[model samples]
Target: MPLDELPPPKVELSDDDWRARLTPEEFAVLRRAGTERPGVGEYTNTHTEGVYTCRACGAELFRSTEKFDSHCGWPSFFDPSHSDAVILRPDDSLGMRRVEVLCASCHSHLGHVFSGEGYPTPTDQRYCINSISLRLVPAED
Candidate 1:
């Protein structure tokens, strides 16, 4: 469904439900706000055309067209599939400040977003997402 037409966040899962729905690695990043090691994410080097959806709720979050080679060791997108597909919040964890991006549907932690790094993308922003937190559905030919 289009983000604008989608209802508000309704995919609330309990800790046990999330653990049962996702693998341990996914649970770590998506449920616990943990960061996957840089350069090791499955989507870090992916160049295929697709819509990347939240692994937790299957909500469309980003598109390959907005993805760029930020070389940040994770899938990086300059924009989302829709402006409301994800929610951004102030994160001051780990002794620093950053923006935390979460799936709007399930409130699952996808990753962080950074801006003003001098990227050539139009938005000059990077949605640094974890591979295990997303599932890419390739676009039709």
Candidate 2:
């Protein structure tokens, strides 16, 4: 699809504003569309019960119940908090074809989703997300 055919950005901020709002690492990953090193994400081993929200826009992205270990070196969720909570776009960068997941509200690069790996998830798909793009809200007892 052409650039004109694409939807408008969810949230627009000046480069300086984005830089000020996010850390250097976050600005690189979310604004510049970079990826963190595998197995190095903060949420990779987090087993806490909570909802994960967008670090940039505080948009709820995933629920703890949907999380699972895919051993793919990232935070894996079987589903988003809601269908519209995240946006999936075709990413052919780096000479590879994959779906890029972004925060619907702030358009931050969360990560990628992969399928057909035969995970025990209900959707059988892994929503591999970046820890820097998410902030956990622990569930209250």
Q: Which stretches of candidate 2 lie over 4 Å from their true place?
A: 1-6
**TM-score, prediction 1:** 0.92
- RMSD versus native structure for model 2: 1.5
For each candidate in the order shown, give its overall lDDT on alpha carbons: 0.90, 0.88
Worst window of 10 by summed lDDT in candidate 1: 1-10
Whole-model lDDT for model 2 versus the true structure?
0.88
TM-score of each: 0.92, 0.93
Candidate 2 residue-wise lDDT, 1-141, digit = tens: 323344666777888999999999999988888888989988999999999999888889999999998888889999999999988888898899899998878777899999888999899999999888889999999
Q: Per-candidate RMSD vs. true structure?
A: 4.5, 1.5
